[model samples]
Target: MADRDSLIADFLSRTAWAGARRAPLAGDASNRRYERLTDPATGRTAVLMDAPPVKGEDVRPFVRIAQFLRGAGLSAPEIFAEDTVYGFLLLEDLGDDLFARVLERRPDLENSLYEAGIDVLAALHAVDPPDLPSYDPALMSELAALAFDKYRSGVVGDANDGIRAEFVARFRQLLEHAATPERPVLIQRDYHAENLLWLPERSGPARVGLLDFQDAMLGHPAYDLVSLLQDARRDVPPAIETAMIDRFVTRTGADRAAFLPAYAVLGAQRNLRILGVFARLGMEHGKPHYVDLIPRVWRLLQHDLDHPALDPVATLLRAALPEPTPDNLQRLKRQ
Candidate 1:
């Protein structure tokens, strides 16, 4: 802890923010931490990102992606200074106008905010994505299994090795069949409301400030779209969700037939993964509040499963996992 404090002090000093007032900012699930640094004389503020290397966190991806997004004319934060050795970055503070916060204060702006969010995806999918890791079926399937291995197993106890094998085989087969995209695009793996900022002052896609994109990958465009519309943290109105989908399809000229199935498949995969993640967070990580969101995620999962294309995966999951009943949720939370 002393070393971390010293490193932060050195980083700020080198960045010419030695006398700034630093206040803690809420952190996400990762090991990274952030601070809002205010210059006393100038009263200007910047964000300090501290991703310590010892915790397996790296600032390089965030730096690289920030440059890419800015070059692409998006509203990623501007990099001011970086200390890659200690994993600290001083960035232009994008302010706190996060989509979730804005909507909470002004429900009337919900539709327009969501439209901008969808437009950002449309613009992103229209271009050739940067070189990144592939979000392929094999990798996706492996991630999806976390639900069964961590969440489900935590709830119902471990399944025998043979049953687990069958479960994985069925899951992978269904995902492989449904993941056919005519042209894959860069997917901001966590493109939900929480990660998006409402920068109405900026123009076009730039009005939507992007955040938490270090895990961007090459994948079907529908993956990020699904993430935005089927958010686990907030209830997106069905009409707004439908309008955004139509807008994206129109703007990108995506084949509705192909895109819809891909959307459903990816949605199912993502929501299922979240179920496992939330369960693991509660059971293994001792963050029990995450369990409260499982019912909402399960509803989204069921919605995706309603698509005929995902019947096999849905059937298997339905048979294997318990419903998010009060009792079941209570039991999982206690774990």
Candidate 2:
């Protein structure tokens, strides 16, 4: 704690707003923390990201991806100053109009806000993607298995190793055959309402400000779309989801038939991963509030499983993974 505080102090001392007043900001699921820096004299505000390297957090990727998004004419926060070695970044404050909050205040703007986000994706896909690790079928399937390995085991008794192995084998084959797109594009693995901000004054794609994309990877285009629609944090109306999917397909000139199934496959993969991740957060990481969101994640996973393209492993998933009933969710929280 002492070292981190000193490092933060040293990092700020070298920046333009050396004596800025700092107020803590709500952090995400990662080890990183953030603070809003207010210039005492001018009331100018900026964000300070404190990502400690010892805790497995890195700021380099955020810096790289932020610059890339800005160069592409989107609204990723501008880097005001950085200390990559100590993992601190002084960033332009994009303000507090997150999509989730905006929709809460003005429910009527849901469609337009969602459309702007879809447009950003379309514009990004049209360009050559950055050099990054691939979110390939093999890696995705391993992550999907977290539903069985973590959630199922935590809720029920430990999952049978044989059953878990059998599911992973089948699921991997399903993803390899059905989910692999011929050409992959950059996917902000966590794109969703909460990570998006409504910047109405900015025109076109810039109207949607991006955040939390340091873990970006090269993956199927449907991957991020699934992240946006099947979000774990909040409910997106079915009408809005359908319309946005159609809009993305139309704008990108993708065949609806091929895209729908891939969309379903990736949706299932992502929701399954979320199920495990949420459970693990409570069971192991002491953040039990995440367990409260499991029922919603389960509902989203079921929606994805209904698509015929997911038939190969859907039955096994249904059989092996217990539903997030009130009792089962309580079990996870107790762990």
Candidate 3:
């Protein structure tokens, strides 16, 4: 704890947050760390992001996406200051009411909140602005590959090799289900129960504060919808999911018949990817709590497999993947 505090202090000192009264904000799996600081000059609260440059991740992408979202008039975190070299940034505080906190405090409000969320997603997907970049299929494939590399191959036991094979084979087929030319939109890959926040100060969809948007991209409209509806961490009610999907299709002017299969496949794909991520986070990252989320996500995959609209893709998942069994049962239990 002391070491982390020292690191935070040193990071703030060398970056834009120097001389501010810095305190740690909860950090995420990414290398970024955030702190709440008092801006000495303005005497206002500021959000400090410690984005150390290491590995393949860079801070510039975060800055770039923030700029793009802001240009689109999306409610993104505002950059208050920056240190080009060490890659620390001072941003405006969105608020403490992350969707997670809101869910915890007012579980009953989910239906209304999700309705607003779909509206935000509709707005984001509707934009074809010149500044935003695309999230091509190549990136989607790579992200999906993480499941095979990190979770299925490494975490699933040798006894369940066939079960592992089933998932991988089906995962490939699932990828094929939603494979399409890129669409233009701001896609926050990790949009889910945690990233969307409630801001009563604002109205309707704008009332939701967006976060962890550095990975935002121009991708399939299905991507963000799947991320929101088939969330691994929480069970979004089927009725609500159905209503919201209908609303999104209407709101975004997407063809209902043409889009349903795409949405289902993408949702299944998102759920499956999270399964692997949860396993990887457990075994490799030593964050085992994520393992508990695996079964729920798998259930979602199964749901997609059963979706009549997604029969082609569902057939693939069913064919490539074996029925659940003790061989797979023990593996599932291990998670």
lDDT of each: 0.87, 0.92, 0.70
Summarize candidate 1's per-residue lDDT along 262-322 as a digit string, tens digits.
8898998899889989988888777888899999999999999999988776777788787
In model 3, the runs with Cα more than 4 Å from the true position are: 1-17, 39-43, 130-134, 155-182, 309-335
Give the runs in model 2 whose Cα sits over 4 Å from its true position. Answer: none
In angstroms, what RMSD does candidate 2 have relative to the true structure?
1.0
Clashing residue pairs in candidate 3 (N, C-alpha, C atoms within 3 angstroms): 135-218
2 versus 3: better lDDT goes to: 2
Which TM-score value belongs to model 2? 0.98
Q: lDDT-based ranking, best first?
A: 2, 1, 3
As for lDDT, the candidate ahead, 1 or 3, is 1
- Can you write out model 3's per-residue Cα lDDT over 208-293, one digit (the tens) per residue? 77788887766677778888888888888899899999999889888777587777767766765676677677766767667667
Window of ten residues with lowest summed lDDT in model 1? 159-168
RMSD of each: 1.4, 1.0, 4.1
- Please give the distance, in angstroms, between residue 82's alpha carbon in candidate 2 and its true position after superposition: 1.1
Score residue 83 of candidate 2 by CA lDDT.
Answer: 92
Tens-place lDDT per residue, model 2, 230-310, is 889999999999999999999999888889999999999999999999999999999999999999999999998899999
